[model samples]
Target chain A: MDNLQTEIRQLIIDALDLEDMTAEDIDPAAPLFGDGLGLDSIDALELGVALRKRYQVRLDGDDPSVKRHFHSVNTLVELVRQHSERTA
Target chain B: MDALASGRPRLHRMTHEKPDGVTTRNTTLIESRGLTPPIAPGRMDSFSLPLAAWAAWPTHAPGCAAPTDSPPPPGAVDIAFVDPMLRRRLGPVARMALNVAHRCLGERTGVPMVFASRHGELARTLAMLHDLAAGEEVSPAAFSLSVHNAAAGVFSIARHDTAPATAIAAGDETLGMALVEARARLSEAHPQLLLVCADAPAPELYQDDITTTESAHALALLFDLHQSRRLHVARHASSGTPSNSMMSLPLADLLAGHRPDAAWSGTHARWEWTLDDA
Candidate 1:
């Protein structure tokens, strides 16, 4: 995994209180919600807040363009990269 | 469930020897006048029900508990027996509350619960406030679980028990109010309900306003409406002296059978609990 993915994975673990998990434990391709890692809506909001604080990127669950990015950790990594590049 | 078998205090002594404050009472007399009005604004409120089971975590005697400010953080209660996924959202008070509630229920399910805490997650709330003050967004997970009823919410979710769950914070009378709520909810259809009371110490910011040493503890009592022996709860006009004691401590003593009767004082009234001989 890239450094961004590792960092985002750590943020997810820290924010969600997934104390027993490590970056490697989370499959980047796995769906973060139902049918995969099994996080709920609360987890999504929590992850959003964590990402906002860490990367200064706001991924609104209500926004159509950003909702797709919440599908997987890889998508979140992509969102953060796109966000950082846009600001740069 | 045998409470003594679970390493709780012996009930044998409770019925045999009277503790300093608790006296053996005739239930018939108290039942006849439960609703008798007091001379003041808040009247007498009393409920008597048989206790099916009782449990408290951190089995340390009340006064012995050190403040949560030391180490292990707010969420670091690794009791080892709890499930990881279910435990993620629980902090110290919720963690201990859920443990004792589970102990009271064991394999039993669907009993509605009324959880009480004097200061529910004050530390967590204070931290969130600090974050917001620094122009940082508070944690969503922390904010969601920081409510007064967070423990009850987590308990029901973890058990997959959709039964009604209520959270209560009534200042000094929190534990007593919860017992009353459980009594009101108990009926023929639901013969039993659980009362779980847990408290962490007040954050230092509010400590100066408090005169008594705050005891950090959690306890759960299972009350059955059908049983003969009763746990008599009574509210009286305040003893006039303010009580800074944590209500759950005396309650733990009452449940452990060390003290058959315990009372806590509030500005308007004083709440009392007594155990009838089984």
Candidate 2:
């Protein structure tokens, strides 16, 4: 869990060009959009593309599960781990 | 303002001061309050204000030169920036509108205003053509957004600004078209008008015909002048060597670089000038 958190945090920073951010600055449970990382709707779309390209996870705009999966670094890592494990 | 001809509209030709590498031309009106919504450094997406506000959170090396003026007006305003990356993904209409809108309303919410983009949204139009080529249905959203005035619609919704909105898409004469409308609206008692004119680099298909680079430029004209201030317009050619005419410079340049003592009025199309506010 710890390792995955670190990896995902780095990915978010790299993908979004969060120039001032380091992995440690990201909170596991904090929101990504408004307060936590200060991302916006367009960032959400870019992140969606990054997730698919990196993890081979297919996302649909209509899927309600995407909300939970994208809640934060911790949730995203857990979701990625669960999906990867099931596929493996 | 006087009509030279009685019955028909008099044609006006715009003359631009040629810039070294840039091919677009524009003139702007700056009110006493500074350009409304004072654009901040690195704040690219003032129309997509979220991108601008988020980008301006003091992280990256500061982008544009710092404003010599005071801090931006307060509010949770919607803004967007035209960082090269995002600009590459947008269509011409979107590109032009976003550029102009950002210039006008980056961070402050004042009276409701109008947005004018001559080319409107060209990317959507290109996509519609591509869909027709592929025997696929043109996306309704794309079709609607393709309209010349769609940028104004998006600008309005993005800002949650319900003030009277007008969008004008006049072919090569977009600036003249929009200016006429702006003048009419002002006559009808509208206090302020935000006039924006932007055009994108010609697309690949049209490249052979029009060789302009992905030219993207916008200007904000704040028409609300205090009674003490007067805008003057007269037909005259520039006497000095034209240095920065063809290219679009940042709003700050137009505010500071031009002769402040001489009030200027000119339309962007032919880049003609009628010195006003002298």
True contacts kept of each: 0.83, 0.00
Q: What is the DockQ of each candidate?
A: 0.76, 0.04
Q: Which candidate is the best by lDDT?
A: 1
lDDT of 1: 0.73
Top candidate on DockQ is 1
Candidate 2 interface RMSD, angstroms, 1 decimal: 8.2
- Candidate 1: tens digits of C-alpha lDDT, residues A20-72: 79989999999999888878888988887778878899765568987789989
Score each candidate by Cα lDDT.
0.73, 0.48
Which residue pairs in candidate 1 collide? Answer: none
RMSD of each: 10.0, 13.9
B202-259 per-residue lDDT for model 2 (tens digits): 4466656432233344444555423223322211222333322212232223333344
Q: What's each prediction's clash count? A: 0, 30
